[model samples]
Target: MRRVTAIVPALLAALMLVVVPAVNARADLLGGKMTLRDENKMGHDFDQILRAQQNMVGDTYITDYVAEVVARVVTGKRPMPFHVKSAVIANPLINAFAIPGGYIYIFTGLIQSVDTESQLAGVIAHELAHVSQRHVVSRIEKQKKVTLLSTAGMLAGLLLGIAAGGGNAAQAGQALVIGSQGAATAAMLHYSQDDEREADHVGLNSLVAAGYNPEGMPQTFEIMLKNKWYDNSSSMPSYLSTHPGTAERITYLNDRIARMPKEFLERKDDNTRLKRVQALIRSRMSPANTALAYWDDMKQSDYTPMDWVGRGITLERLKRLDEAQTAFEKALSLAKDDPLVVREAGIFYFKSGQADRALGLLQKASIMNKDDAMALFYLARLQAEAKQYGEAARNMRKVNELVPEDWEVHHHLGMILGESGDVFGGNLHLAYAAVYSMRLDKAREYLKRANELAQTQEQKDQVRELEDAIQARAQIGK
Candidate 1:
């Protein structure tokens, strides 16, 4: 399946590439408008291309938090033809993009960049408006005559640069754009100035309707404007590099916010959840020195409980173990029962060889935040190291379920399964772990071992299923 559309915060910059189908099929300009069924299929295929390329966050806690915010924004909007879903990307760029059929992704950097949850929601609402208004679909209709291969190669190459592959496709795309088709492809992918205005108008209403402050939409734009991403061309595609109308748009948004009721404008957004998620991302996902600097720069009075945890994490990354311990202990003192703090602090201790102290904290964290796969993973490992194989295997299986695509989780789960005497299950998970880690030969070896050990028909069927998955995964790389 061949079609993919541009994605973004037009309020921040020009639309950026989120998906560019690499398939040979033709665009689905099927007479009237594209159907829901068609878009969903295209979106599914687009997801495959993306997954084949970059790491989408497999952490349930982070992704679920973003998805919950998406759900809230959707609640305020008119009934949508498509179901909007959220995927958090493991990218450092401060950008967000939406694809056809309602799949939106926000970079980890974007999460860390925003000051509040409402600011994030505002960007999300704007992207949602683009989808609801069918701006990309409309633009495609007008520009369908442009050579598909050049357009596809350009977009595919552009987002590819952001996701993982070297800029080969991007360079080729840029070269093609410099040729005759440049204008048409550009028009097709970017929202018109008018379209951007309309999305702002529509999205602001949705943001307010969703019970967020109207100032958030404009505030987020201000953050982007001040960000160095606005100045750095190589940081994002050239198309998004030039945002001439940003100041004007901000002026208008502020003017509109001025006319809203004072109490409504005064409505405060709860940043509790956003801060927790941001702390986790900064502590665990960001570059170590940069994260440490960020946390360090914050005034001591402004540091939240999770901020202290974030500080501890970065300090640990720098091997400042004594300092890290101090930070974690301070965070625990401030918010001892907070699940994120408890979980992260526990992990630090576990790794620091203070497993006896870690055991109870991690167990409490697992109970408090049952959905946090990371916490459960540590708890399971702790149990495994203590030779509590039955409990360890059980907990690891749950982690595997939540983070199925994660190779390390699968590997540990496989080891736990082996210790618990499920040799067939162990081999199956090991094979899966190898597949996810891209160790194809190792995966095949484990798959063969699994098949041999499968005595039951159920186990045989499971082995066959895993084989099919590995084959499909291989095809994506091709």
Candidate 2:
């Protein structure tokens, strides 16, 4: 096919390499650039491996939230790579992992249990340390000597379990455990305690250097210590289960905090951000819980814009739309021209079927902050629904350019193009739309030409399934 052929073989070859470790002569860990032999061994690219694994784990919201806060704290100070993707898994364990690249995943349970953002920062910083120090690759190298075949076997086993709904495995070839995928994840947890401690120590310094409160380290450790005692298991909470001992580490952190300058102990943020995060969580809670948290924030006697925003969100979620509107408007009144407040109101209006109102508010907010891609995208969605097709397409195109990987936008654009009657161009976009959607029939239709498309076997398999399903649906229609 008239695909990007020059790079396609290497791309396809890369996909095959990482599909499973058995294809490889050596399971070379990620660190430097991939060698041809290493490439041959895995049969797929390492990047694909990481991406597949991330998709397997799903949302890691706590990680994202913590990373956002830390990013704010360390902004302009550290030369950390711009994190391209972040996710928070729904898992309630205390574990966090970062791939060789900038992908970081944090478990929700970890956030629910943490006492402070700094503590969370410590965890994130530690994971960032892993990425920065190339420790994941280092561990991979260390594992190679311990027994490569068994390691690959174990990793493979664990991954199979995860894929089949068995559990989490840190590495590729571990012995497969039956039942919950938790077992495999628990296995990876074993090697990283010392690494975790080192990360905590180093991460604390990183946090302080970045001007976050270093006291968050020891304070969080203390909370973990209490949880440790409260737990009946020999293993620490799932967070610490993978990491090494925390008691000595807590003491060490306390000693460091005691001896260090008093400034680190007294650090704080706008608090609005933290409270907003808390509020966001509360807003998603059950109605009873939402009411409780909202009242807790209000009755606390310490009022803040975030509290108002939080209560508004909870009320909105509770379907008390008018009350929600009032709360958000009050927040706006308190803080005139706040983009966050305006954005929230715009979202409420948009979701409430008031497309014009939502568009008006969002457009004004975007003008106030022209770089708000989300605001622009939402406005575009409303416009599209309202049959303002040309405007919607333009906005969609803009957002697509800004966030090329967002498949939904591409899909929308493709549908618009198809309906607009530029059949060939539309088909080309539709092919991309199918690939992004992992739709088989559409991919097959688009890939009918002898194109050297670089798709992993799994992706190819998904396309085939989609094609079959599409055919079945069409038959039913006929």
Global fold similarity of model 2 (TM-score): 0.67
Tell me the tens digit of each residue's lDDT in model 2 across 1-478: 0001011111111111222332222433433343334422232224334332433221122234465765754452267643424555433334555554455555544565566677777667766665555444444344442223333443355344344432233223233321222332233334366666666666776878877777776666666667777743312354454446777778877787798888768876554455555554445432445454646655535656656766777777678889777877777778657765676678778877777778878888767866555667777777777777788778778767765534456667766655655344345556655554445466568645313342567545644554554453322201
Candidate 2, residue 273: lDDT: 51
What stretches of model 2 exceed 4 Å from their correct place?
A: 1-95, 107-117, 145-188, 224-237, 285-293, 300-303, 419-478
lDDT of each: 0.73, 0.53
lDDT of 1 at 252: 88
Best by lDDT: 1
* Candidate 1 ranges with C-alpha deviation above 4 Å: 1-32, 141-187, 229-244, 298-302, 419-421, 434-448, 471-478
Residue 21 in candidate 2, Cα distance off native in Å = 9.5
